[model samples]
Target: MSNRPITPLLDKVCCPADLKGLSDDQLKQVAHELRQEVVSAVSETGGHLGAGLGVVELTVALHAVFDTPRDKLIWDVSHQCYPHKILTGRRDRIRTLRQEGGLSGFCKRSESEYDAFGAGHSSTSISAALGYAVARDLGTAPEAGVGDAIAVIGDGSLSAGMAYEALNHAGHLGKRLIVILNDNEMSIAPPVGAMSRYLNRLYAGAPFQEFKSIAKGAIRHLPEPFQEGAKRAKDLVKQVTVGGTLFEELGFSYVGPVDGHDLDQLLAILRTVKTRATGPMLIHAITKKGKGYAPAETAPDCGHGVSKFDVATGVQKKAPANAPSYTKVFAEALIREARADRKVVAVTAAMPDGTGLNLFAERFPERIFDVGIAEQHAVTFSAGLAAGGQKPFCAIYSTFLQRGYDQIVHDVAIQRLPVRFAIDRAGLVGADGATHAGAFDTSFLANLPGMVVMAAADEAELVHMVATAVAHDEGPIAFRYPRGEGVGVELPEKGVPLEIGKGRIIQEGKRVALLSFGTRLKEVREAAQALSAEGIEPTIADARFAKPLDEDLILGLAREHEALITIEEGAIGGFGSHVAQLLAERGVFDHGLRFRSMVLPDTFIDHASAEAMYAEARLNAADIEAKVRDVLSGATAQAARRA
Candidate 1:
């Protein structure tokens, strides 16, 4: 690797405050250098690339125009914060982006003051900025000028209902806020839904610009007395001609469809918007995802997130010969089932490739639906599909599912709709970190009245769960799996449906019982083996159904073993929480039995290698062994004390 000294301009810019001194030309150069820095950093670290690349000039322009830390600039989704990170006191540490103990992959409030508001999920910035703007308005002493709240959001994010909700509210509240719509025509995949279509029409047609030019020409031709009347006529013409009167009707003074990449235009527009705009205003800026990089630009699925790659050739590193990922396994299983059964359909909220449904989309184009970034809509839409005698497998990442919690609870669970949720990335997502971790799915879904929650112990079990979901037509069911490749088990040609609310004993032993949930079975097995070396043969049971808990299997294990440990890849209220509730209800804990729960610690794990994050959370094999040993040793000490 060639070692290069950090440029002096970059090194000097610790914050947006420092950027105020730079000339506009220097700012443009800085934007270019920042993009290069982002490219270099993400090439090494591997993160959200296209979004950041698209926003480099915007980032530079925003910081140059606004008083950032003071002005509370919130980036929607925050995936595009690489350039923001590079500008705000993190230039030297850019290489460590997304690594454990390094700079966060997204904007994190705890990480830096410049972050303003943390975001991982999209459509949150407008709401967050509005909140800040309101707070600033409420906090203003007579002498203090209004603090600015700038929300930089992507066109893809605008598809979500929450974004529109915030826009409506922001407009009604009449807050001093600036919403910068970064129209890149992409989310991870090409954006879908009506909003994306509207943006395309607005930008592609150039009708607004054409109308504005025509009005100006008309004004030049009109006499002085007629000029004033023509201007009012022009306003009426704009209302009919320019489509953004929708925003104006909502109370926001809508601005431009300006070139986001143009440094001078962005700065000039932002400067004018910053000073002149009274209420909420949206400056629509058109941008290209993966602007500088040609390979990413042309790639149909715009280079959103990528693996570590060779920047020169744009070649992604080849995967090692290993088992197919759980996502791929889930996809294959779904495809096999769909081929056999016509009722089986699939849905993904802006994540066909991520959820491994791209294969399904290609094969069964008619059955699959890609609901852009709108998780709530995807859930309710799936409910509609299910009600229409179709088995809609709403395949979503665990974290993204959080956005549709209300829909799942109300539309699916309450009404008892048979919407199969193929929840991928169901545990701690490495590199993307805590915001993307699927740690709450089990806990949240389990509490829903009629919801059936299952966790896959391995790829094979994931296939079984998919079959189980297909077979069950009573209520909402969710099957969760991790982010990476599955264990090297050969996939069965046909998936066999599993018995609902049942668990199987993987290994039978004595003294201690290790109840494993999800893909953490591998670690549990290793920990059990280590315990065996110490003459403690622990029983290992895979609690397949998180909600139902396999009560018979759990009670049997609790009675047979001296101590019980429930392990899951989620937070406190998940599988472990269910197990705890079961044990308490059965009066098993009345004997004062030695019980321990192994759940992800109540902390936001940083971006890092999966192994490293697991190790940090003490969920890795070694850490699992240590925890098991500690619990067993504690049981021994307690026994001695009782005696």
Candidate 2:
């Protein structure tokens, strides 16, 4: 509160409408104030810092010129919507970012009308904006009154195939749409691919200070009232070509490579394009990620994402890690496998750093591939690698892997390719919320035939799973691990390949058997200890493989224990469902076995800490303990009825 900046110009602005009243100089002042507010707020409540900082001037200029909430302004993968959120009457709640019961880190349609299209994934903006433009043309929602549809996409987003698909379609449709290329030359990671290179050339060749064209003068020279006579027919087709660029080829009137931070240049270019654009138009604005903040600007990731930090020093106030993170563990295990086998290579779809493949890339640079933001290609490419007798480990985040599901099914599953899918962030991820949560991967992957699905109970288990994936050249195998640190378990010096489709018992006890999958075993163990206190002493068995079902272990648990409870960090149709199906088919339920599955609720959870999210999901230690007691009581009731 003490560090909050004085914003005389910005204080007057209540909404985007208020921005329209401010002079260009005052708007520039507002942008400066907005940047200060962003930096200050993020220092207390960390979130996407660099992206918001990058687009301060662009955000101000767009709101100042365009009629948003009416004219659909879509931000591609709207992580940078924090400043936009602040300007659109949400500054009061800015400090509560990424906290429980607070504002979401990403743009949400439910949160505000100004956020035209909600996005947590990248490269969907062009398609969404095009849909809005088409809807406006078709008079689909006349009463709502949608105007010029604008998509502000980053340079890295263009690397995805979806953006180009929309571009190709938009060119064909020839609608009055607008696309702003927010060319920061990076997206979370330093961008790669031909598209990134092409954009780089555009950025390098263009005069950074000026617009690509003198757009205002051209619009001025054209007469507003064209003749209705036979002579008017000659100029029917508007021969408007701002510049012969790539966007022009896509049927968009190309405008910039303009200085995004320069308010005068941004306002002028936006205003000129806003008036003159008939068909689809593109304005390329070059911006520096984390522009104002020196600490962020100089950093490797440009402070892409951060924890709460001191404003002066820019040092994060993170709690000391008790154990290595699951990501690091995964990277270390993967590196070990790669070292032992020349055929063992890694592939990541734009998330080398996020998936911990960056570490792998440092050692075996030639063997590692960072395919830029294209998960679909990454999956099929790995499948191809496997087909060529190479063990390609496709390291992707669980949520991101969903994008490549069709490829996984068609390319990997059908052929039974041994593409080791290292699914990172495999459970209820915090902050990024429901969109980024890896809830469905288990269900989706396990459903496929010949697919081996395994979840790591701890960092040590993760090592074995990596080894298992490498050794198993039979079919497609996947191993999932959660995002944060492990429970400080001592890791093995080298991983031993696990026996396929088998489970290991942790604690053999009496009345109830707790069948655990994934990282939830930690909570299960805690519940067992608490249950031991109550004289319950429930048995705990880690179900290492989800797909293959571990039939012998599962059936033994069902027959031996009075009650059996299955726990997993996945949704309904995953491990528990598979176990349920097995028991049902084998008539275990018919033999009076009291079975229950504890899973994430059939609802989309909002952003919170992983602990808070698990509480809401009702899959914590207490919840597990409660389920065991409840089931045991039910089993006793059944026994009394039999007597």
Candidate 3:
């Protein structure tokens, strides 16, 4: 609040309707104010900064030109929707982004009517927009009275196969759809793959740059009957020297490479497109990711994601780290393994920094491969590398790996390819919320045959897991670790691999046993301490491998303890479910051994701090102790009644 910038023009605009009343000159002021507001809001909230700043003029133009809600404007990934949110009557709640009971960081359909589609994952806008277009044509979506469906997508998102698939269908249908390709030459990481290079070449050529005005002038002069054909011919000529030919061939009329920051240009072009007849038109607008603000514009990644920072200095206020991050630990461990093994290589799906592959890339530059925003390709590509006798570690976030699941099952698991999966952010991530939660990887991967799944309890254990992934070339193996820093533990000089299916006991106790699968071991220990203070010393053990089921340790605990509780930081069908199946098959339940599985609740928990989210999920230390008491007390009462 102290750092909020003055936005006199932006203050008057409550909605898109207010924006329509402004003149072109006034709109320019609004755009400038909007950019300032976005920077100020993100400086306070510390969410996605660069993307929103990039699309300020485009947001203003789209709202001004189109009849929203009816027109159905969809933002791909929707991380860049902050500017859109402010203009669409959500300005009052803009400061509360990514906080509990506040506005979501990403778009949510339930949040507002202006939010035409909810999105977290990238490259989905075009597909959803095509659906809207089809629905409008079929008269199935008459409730909102759809007019046009416009998909605003980023350049990096074009790498995904789904986008192309949607484009192909949209073109074939010949429906009135508008796709604004916001080519900022950046995704999370500076883009990778052929598509990025193609986009780069599009704006780089001098001929393509000159063709924009020339083609527009030529098309306007052509006879009304000849205009359509002449425009296609010009597009074909432009495609020969520049990019967008790929999109054109897929069957859409391509326009621009327009300057995104120029409000006059954006407004004129958008207004023209809104009036003209179109069959799947793609407006390729060239933009700088962090356009308006100098601090973000100059910064690497354009301040893609930031913590709360000083506005004048542009220096972020980051919390001091108490321990080594799980990401860094994994990276260093992988570097160690790569030093020993020349055959090892790393792969990431456009998230080198996010997954800690940036550290590995520094060590083994040629060996690291970033496949851009293509997770499916990353998985299958890793499988191919493994097939070629190279140890390929596909370092991907657990939530992102969901996109590559089919490849995991078909290419790696079925073939028993020795691909190592370094699954980062394996539990409920704070701020990013349910859309990004790594809750289902454990459940999905554990069920796959020849797939080995492991989760680290802390930093030191993560090192060992990395080593384990390196040494074990048996099949497709994955090790998951949560986001942020580890639970401060002493580090070993080097990690040594563990036995395939073995688990180690943390503490020995009496009547009740608490079996933990992932980072929840810390909470289990805290719960155990609380129980001990009350004269109940509960046993705790870490089930390192959820897939293999640490049979000896789990069965032994079931046999000796009066009641056993399994806890994991995943969904219902994950580690706990696997443990229960193992116990039931062993006839442990028939002997009246009270068993309970603690997992995340069925509903999706919203954005909040990690501790608060865990509390909401009932997976905190207090909840753990309560569950143990409930199970044990119930068994004690039943025994007394029987006696």
Q: What would the per-residue lDDT of candidate 1 be over residues 227-306, giving only the tens digit for each residue?
A: 24213323433533544656776777665566778786677667756665667778777788999988778877767888
Q: In model 3, which runs have C-alpha deviations exceeding 4 angstroms?
A: 207-243
lDDT of 3 by residue, 1-643 (tens): 5567788989999989898889999999999889889888888889999999999989999999898878899999999999999998999999999988889989999999999999999999999999999998898996758998999999999889899889989889888889999999888888877888887787676554565564455345323422483265344345434446777787777766677777766776677677764578888887888887889999978888999987888899999999989999999999999999999999999899999999999989999999988899999999999999999999999999999999999999999999999999998999999999989999999999888999999899989988898888889899999999989999888999989988999999999999999999999999999889999999999989998878999999999999999999999999889888998898999999999999999999999988899999999999999999999899999999999
TM-score of 1: 0.92
lDDT of each model, Cα atoms only?
0.84, 0.88, 0.88
- Over 4 Å off, model 2: 206-244
Q: Model 2: which residue pairs collide?
A: none
Instruction: Itemize residue pairs with steric clashes in candidate 1.
Output: none
